[model samples]
Target: MIDFWLAAGLLLLVALSFLLIPVLRSRRAQLEEDRTALNVALYQERVAELQTQQEEGVLDAAQMDAGRAEAARELLADTEGVAAPRVTRLGKPAPLLAAILVPVLGLGLYLHFGASDKVELTREFSQAPKSMEEMTQRLERAVAAQPDSAEALYFLGRTYMTQDRPADAAKIFERTVNLAGRQPELLGQWAQAQYFADGKKWSDKVQALTDEALKADPKEVTSLGLLGIAAFEAERYQDAIDYWNRLLEQLPADDKSRIALQGGITRATEKLVASGGQVVKAPVAKATALLKVSVDLAPDLKAKVQPGDSVFIFARATNGPPAPLAAKRLTVADLPATVELSDADAMMPQLKLSNFPEVQLVARISRAGKPTAGEWIGRSQPLASSTTAPQTLTIDSPDK
Candidate 1:
């Protein structure tokens, strides 16, 4: 920001020079005009003296003419190199006043309308924060500077949750939902924050939020974790085990939280056994969905497309979000090849194929390797996500 202001000040100085330089030059021209007038007066005085001598018979006509010629020559010599006086419609004071007002008015307008606060926020974020508190302060200022920024609000809410300010986190998450739409992940965060904010007591509003999130995305991790905690707190050990097991399945092998989550499941299972209740394991095979697809270029497009062009095979929910439930990547040369898209290939855990009842398969050919859009595309009819039969897709039509 300091560098930016310095550059702006330099530009202002350049602008002021344009207005000031002309005035300074006009002053120099005035001085030259005044000196020329003074020399002409001195020449007239010498001519008057010579005429007086000739009238008194001290000099003849020829000598008098010579004397006048010498006086005129001296006047011309004194004024020889002087430039013509400049004519200005606006005098010195006007340009000087303009020079003063240009910067002042420009600065005033810029302060009122420019993105200086955003610039400051950017500069602050470039440095590593010394502490969490300092980072929080910067995020708060960023949210204040850009109230409409959903991404900033989401981060601030997460930060508040880490700081144990659940009430603040809940409010920020609500704002985030309003600005960014009721996304499953955002809904899960909002529900978790609201649950903690209400002193760990469940409410109808929290229930609604969690239900909506899970309905949209069954594998929403935050909501799953939150429900497990709620069930445990309510002394429903079996219910806690169920929710934790569902969450555990969604986690990756390398996730640091997996150890703690496994411990939680074990604790829940032990408590359920102590209560003389039978523990029922969830059906693991039913939870995993896989689609086998054979993709190939259309006969008509074979001559038009390069063999090295990229091909994307993916499945998206027919009745849910536009995001792919599962996807695969290959090259055009690999066409007429078989590929598999499973829950393991899910773009997001909450958007897995097992979470949706029905989906559509799409195959696209793109020179740019982008999945969302491409030159040629083919789509299969809506089919059950749990379908075991092989599907065939050919890239036959231009992408709309």
Candidate 2:
């Protein structure tokens, strides 16, 4: 922003100087024209006076001629015309003095008061407004200026969203939908605004519109993701999985859509398992340490999964799961259910508590149970050593 402003100001100053040059030149030329005209008139008048005097016999022809010549010479001297010596402004002191002083004055002023850091033009325009009234006025004016303008309406809807007036935003977006005719891209944009602005009440409507958008362009990742979200909200887990999984294929190799798709999978699977699953009692021990595992699933996700697959928690045979240790699962209400992995009991599954102080733990899972993705979480000791306790990570809920 600063660089842009500096360049702009320099260009403006140069342009203004160019524009001023013609006006100054005209003033100088006008000064010369006036002086030339005055000298010509004076010379003519002096010649006429000399002639009149000679005609009246007050002086001889030679005397009159000499007088006329003298007058002409005097006039020429006064006007610096014929036989005038050259005057050198290049050697003048005042102008040189002014040149030095002008720069010094400019430098002083700039150092004292004008070296601004603020890039003061439309930079302010880029900052979002805090007040809704100003936003409303601007939005209204923009929409009014171009009645059938899809972009204008879209801007207005965004403004409304920023102002927390989703209902109003919905109205504007509906209008935008109407204005955007059959242009699929524009229509998709309108539908997107409408979907978000409608908030979850019109889920079915959003679904229909987004479907239409996808039909127009199957590669619309944004609409596909939204459709997945809507489906999840509506409790259609399989359909949500389909939408997000399809969306994942359309995403760039390194994108969050794939992660989102995986997360959705984890969530659905967890819910289904928790709803009804058999639990074998694993005994607890006298000495125990908490294991928190950091799992990175699907580094480059090609498909979306929701909780139909099992996630196996494993630790390094010598260092826990590569990096992260194991911790308890977080409930949706920000509650952590106690999960103890080791104790001094025989029934407890081959758990060694005294093994690795540097627990390199990982959470591994699979897409279609083909292979597991276990991401490294650093040692639990640092988190355990912090002055402030780490918050429990809530899992698998949209609001969370």
Candidate 3:
């Protein structure tokens, strides 16, 4: 920010020079004109003296004419090198007034419209924060600077949760969901925050959020984990075990949270058995919905695309929100390659391929790294989500 202000000041100085330089030149020209006037007065006084001598017969005609000529020569020498006076239609006040107003108006307009706060936030985020509190403050300022940015709001909400400020977290998460759409992870986050904010008591609002999230993507990790916690708190040990076990399956084998999640499931089972209940082991879930796709660039477009440009392949529901149900990102260099999209690749649990009955496959080449907009695209007709056949997609047409 300091650097930004310094650069702005330098630019202001440059602008002021345009307005001020002319005024300074006009002042110098005025001084030259004054010197010319003074020389003319001295020449007239000398001529008057010469004429008086001639009229009194103190000098002959040739002597009088020579005296006048010498006086004229002296006047010319005195006024030599004086610049021509400039005619300034603007006068002195206009430029001076403009010089003063330029910086002031620029600052006033910038304060009203410039993104200085956002610039500061970008600079702050470039460096590692000293503490979590500092990171939270930066995120908050970022959200304030870009009120429509769901990404900033999401990070701030997560930060609030880490700080144990669930109430604040809930509000921020709610706003995030509203802006980014009710993505399964965001919904789960909102539910978790709301649950804790309500003193860990279950509410219909939280229940709906978790339900909606789970319905979209059954393997949504956050919703699964949150549901297990809620069930455990309500002393529903078997329910807790089931939820935790489901969550446990979603985690990677080497994930550190897997150990903690397994421990939770074990405790839930023990509690259930101790309460004179039979421990029912849940069967392993069936293989998740998967779609195999071979992606390649069309021959016509191969020459137009850079190898390093982004290529996005995804499946989206035919009748659902525009957000992709499953997605994979690769570089154009990786094209003519096969990739898989499944629940594991779901962007949002409820929006997963398994949840949607019909979906369309799309492949796009994007130079700007945005999934939604691209330079070229290929799309498939709607197909069943459960189709077992492999799909082929090519980027052949310009993106509209």
Best model per lDDT = 1
Rank candidates, TM-score, best first: 1, 3, 2
Worst 10 residues of 1 by lDDT: 281-290
Kindly list the per-residue Cα lDDT of model 1 for residues 1-400, writing each as its tens digit.
Answer: 8899999999999999999999889888999999999998999899899989998999999999999999898988999999988788887899999998999999999999999999998999999999999999999999999999999999999999999999999999999999999999999999999999999999999999999999998889999999999999998988999999899878877799999999998988888899898799876664479899888878999999988999989999999999888888999887789999999898876678988889999998889989888899999999999999999988899999
Look at candidate 1 and give me any clashing residue pairs: none
lDDT value, residue 62 of candidate 1: 99
Ranked by TM-score, the better of candidates 1 and 2 is 1
Q: RMSD of model 2, in Å?
A: 19.4
Mind giving the per-residue lDDT tens digits that candidate 3 earns over 320-354?
99999889999999889899888878886445688
Candidate 2, lDDT over the whole model: 0.54
Off by over 4 Å in 3: 284-400
Candidate 2 lDDT over 1-400, as tens digits, reads 6686577567656655654555555556667667767887988898888889888988898998898889788776766743323354543454445555655675578657762433332354467867778667756865664578788788888777777776787677778777776455545555566666666654566667777878888767667777777777776666666676666655556665567677986675565456573323234334554443333333333134344443434333343333323323221122122233332321222334433453333233333342234221211222221112222221221111
After TM-score superposition, the amount by which residue 317's alpha carbon in candidate 2 deviates from its true location, in angstroms, is 47
Which residue window of length 10 is worst by lDDT in model 3?
279-288
- Best-to-worst order by lDDT is 1, 3, 2
Clashes of 2: 27
